[model samples]
Target chain A: MKDVYKSSMLYDFYGELLTEHQKEIYEDFILNDYSLGEIAQERGISRQGVHDMVKRCDRILNGYEEKLHLVERFSKTKEDVRRICQLADSDINQKNISEIKMIAQEILDNY
Target chain B: MKDVYKSSMLYDFYGELLTEHQKEIYEDFILNDYSLGEIAQERGISRQGVHDMVKRCDRILNGYEEKLHLVERFSKTKEDVRRICQLADSDINQKNISEIKMIAQEILDNY
Candidate 1:
């Protein structure tokens, strides 16, 4: 259901590793929301050809994320930061707040 | 310089992506410090074969790091944390300590 969203995130993390042509086509489809027909015309390829290339790029990016897990770990760290921020702003005890802040800071420092 | 050390660090970041064969051979060479001839005998391959495979693994791991820079960024963040700890311990102003802590915390959270 969210293949495109996940692909784009993976692209953001590993797009530099892709070939130049792959970047252009992937960006057009994922970032620019270009239709397959439009990409085909722009790249001087058939619509089916464009689709295949896009699929190839998807596999490439997904493989990188599978090995790296950069996005998943990043999301978890972000959630931790959010929780710490909320705790800091709440009417919590001062000692508890500092303890929570220290833990959150440690999580970030480790990453 | 320090190719073995660098290779081991890269392996720590991306070794899971390699094939089973690659993992075994690479571990023997880099982690176990086995000689090329020893790995070749243990794996039932030639010395030259072991050498080539180890070199290939190096290239593959280095390629991943080049694109992701996970280790480079991790090292930088670690340095920031070190500075924060040092500043906190030093006879610095409380205002300066909190400011440095906030900046370092932000860097970790973003990462």
Candidate 2:
């Protein structure tokens, strides 16, 4: 995924946990496509301060993702569901049903 | 589920993100079944302090679950997978396959 897109997705998932100040700066810089100098001027902080805050936000968001893995599991579950759909579209067979059950069990086991 | 079991599940999922002090105190009080006074004396803190800390930890962990819904989704997904397994165990037919596919699609849509 693109850097900004990934950041935004992380932000969407975990942004509420961030402080109000961090949220404002992160939105302006990453989501709104504002320049460092522009956000710095608006927030009455130095450009380096704004830059540091954005980097800190990224680290914090990534840290949450690493620990929680909610996003990762979601992607994997979606893929598994898609695979099940494909299996279902094929000819109905006992083996096919077994495979579907196996996939579902895998999904359950993962949690 | 039992209170301790539920707390342990939350701790297992999100406890590592907590401070070391929080983890130790929580493990003692919740997992080891230590009383507030016992924990407080062990840590050289007041019973009220230990009680406050445990309550705070509960709030924090519950807050994380509220926002992220990882635990909630895990339970729901497990139930869905069990439903899929049951559907699979029935007679193999077009209706059964369609139901399986529909369940899979529901899982995908949820994510």
Candidate 3:
């Protein structure tokens, strides 16, 4: 289940690299919570075939993550942005906000 | 010279995925400006072999960029960050600074 969430996030970052067919299968499986049997029926393939495709999609996404780390950095950036917001609400210096924003902008712009 | 710089920058982002042999040959040729003959002699390969490896490395790096757009985003983020810095320098709402910082942090964190 947790893997599903991770895979979904990884998909968001690297989904463009996958085939359209793989994208549909992965979306239905991970995001829509469809069973492999259901996905197989929908795609007109064997259940085992569906399983294999989903696993292959996972490997492709994971491989990209291992090398590029777009998903990992994206999660960290979210946390850092949250912290910056919290700090902003407090008595932190406004000038610090400027510097922090530059760093944050750089990260958001890329991923 | 332009191609060399671009390759060097691409290498900064995706060089790790290359084999050690590719890495050494690429660095010597691109980064160190070694002549093909020099690198060929150094690596005990023919000049043609060195030429082929460098072209292969370019294709490999270019392929990753086309799929991922990491390098493209990275270049844009730098530009955006510069803009954020400029905005910070100019007179602006302090609270807006906070909100903008959050976005910037998110971008920077990922790429």
Candidate 4:
């Protein structure tokens, strides 16, 4: 379940960068939860072929994440925004306001 | 100048998805401001080839932005963060604090 979640998130972030065929097969295997044999029969390819393509697509998506870290940065920014919301909810004071400003600036700086 | 800025931002966000050769040529043309003829001479390719590559890179980057809107989202989130900072800098009140929370939630929601 965790692997599925991570694959979906990675696909959400980088699937567009994949080739058309890769996208179709990967969407089936990962997003649609199609079995390898199912995808193979549907695409008129061997199960091994489907498996290799899925692996290649996973590698490609992971490579993009490794290089760009878009997903990582996004997760960090979301956490920071949550922190800001928490600070805002706590107390309306000078220190909390300053902390909010600091966090907001960090988000702007692509934290 | 404006085009350069936009190009750099797009490239910064999506360039890692491009091939290494495309990255090199694109960095030269868009980021380094290298002329097509110069790039062609340096790369031992025709000026037309260099032009086409740069244009293709632009299209690819723009397509990613069009599909994913990462760069657009980043800009919007940055603006929201700036607003949060401004609100924090101004008078501290219940209304302003709530506004900050709203904006922070907006950021968290991937605005």
Candidate 5:
């Protein structure tokens, strides 16, 4: 989950719970990689305002993550899927493949 | 990116910044989903000790994420990869497939 799109996915999953302005700025700055100054100009706000908004939105998102741990759970599931895919890509034995598939299914079921 | 494996990946990528005890307990509790009592007993610490270590480790992990944003970047890349894979799986046009491939390559280059 240390990848860019994964970050955006986490944000997208939980960011909707934030304020509308928070969501907008976060999507632009974080997901789209818009500069703080660019976001400020686009939103007709000061650069500091954009920065503060992003910081606040980050706090909100991370706060939810700490308490709820859904993002953590989701990330672990993704890692398991990647590991299974990797195993399958390699020449794994049938028993190993079945185990990987079972783990994948368990993860999918939980999600 | 909100998947469990993704979360563990993020933790694995950055958890090293924490204390050894912190890392051990966190991996077991979060990644392996060991109970607090279980981790505490295994580590020869009190239940409260395990709880505190996990909380502290969580703060440390989230703190790094806030300041550095590496996990965020990685998560976004994973999402882009998944999106491209999905598009490839579907009957996307040549132009779109080329576009997706280009995007995937760009992502791979960054990682």
Candidate 6:
């Protein structure tokens, strides 16, 4: 589930690289959750065409992911941030909030 | 900037949607840091072709970003994770570690 979210976010970030046909099909199939048949009907293409396009697009998305590992990096960064936030919110720690703030600042600085 | 990182991650995630030509240009321009002229020379295309392709790809990437805001969400999640980790690390906080764990679990649950 998280992977899907991460992938979607990645998709949002790089979707413009797609051709028009690829974008239309992806928007319908992935983003809109339209079925193959539904997308085929909407686009006036065969269900096979829709399926092939979706699969091709998926391969392209996954290819970039495999090579770059951007989502994984983002996920790690997110985990780091979450840990710091929890520290800040904890009542047991007062001084730690400053530390957490520093960490957050560091992340932001690198960001 | 974090935005650039986020965008890069997103690009990595969704880059497969691009056509082969688009991917080649993108890999060169964005990932490989080749200038438009360099990319054009390498691809044996005009500099204008390289420039136009890069701009078009940027638009497509930004378009998905505008609609989905995946990188933004990922960034927020990362911040939350960092906070939680800081809480766990603090010596002043003993019980807060458990709270931090809970938050991490919650994020994971939803993740």
Best by lDDT: 4
Candidate 6 residues lying further than 4 Å off, grouped into runs, are A1-6, A98-111, B1-111
Worst 10 residues of 1 chain B by lDDT: B85-94
For B1-111, candidate 1 gives per-residue lDDT tens digits of: 237878887887789889999999999999899999898888798999998998899899898888878777666655654554454444545464455547545764554
Models sorted by lDDT, best on top: 4, 2, 3, 1, 6, 5
**Per-residue error (Å), model 6, residue A51:** 0.7
Docking quality band of candidate 2, CAPRI definitions: medium
lDDT (tens digit, per residue) of candidate 4 on A1-111: 327877887898888888899999999999899999999999899999999999899899898889888888878888888999999999678999999998888877762
C-alpha RMSD by candidate, in order: 4.1, 3.9, 4.1, 3.6, 12.5, 8.2
Tens-place lDDT per residue, model 5, B1-111, is 124575576685566566677777888988888888998888899999888887787777776667546667656755655554454345535554455546544553453
lDDT-wise, the better of 1 and 5 is 1
Candidate 4 lDDT, B32-107, residue by residue in tens: 8889999999999999999899889999989889887888877888788889989999999999999999999977
* lDDT per residue (tens digit) for residues A58-106 in model 5: 7777766665565566567556555544544445355544555465445
lDDT of 6 by residue, B64-89 (tens): 56765656766665676566546545
In model 4, where do residues sit more than 4 Å from their true spots? A18-56, B34-50
Q: What are the Cα lDDT values of the candidates?
A: 0.74, 0.85, 0.75, 0.88, 0.65, 0.67
Worst 10 residues of 3 chain B by lDDT: B102-111
User: What is the Cα-based TM-score of model 4?
Assistant: 0.77
TM-score for candidate 5: 0.45
Q: Which scores higher on DockQ, 2 or 3? A: 2
**For residues B3-92, what per-residue lDDT tens digits would candidate 3 score against the true structure?**
987898788777877999999999999999999999999889999999999999999988878877767766765565555556555655
| Candidate 6 TM-score restricted to chain A | 0.77
Better of 4 and 6 by DockQ: 4
DockQ, per-model, please? Answer: 0.21, 0.66, 0.25, 0.62, 0.03, 0.14
Candidate 3 chain A: minimum summed lDDT over ten consecutive residues — where? A83-92
Q: Model 2, range B25-87, lDDT digits (tens) per residue? A: 999999999989899999999999998899899988988888776777767877877888888
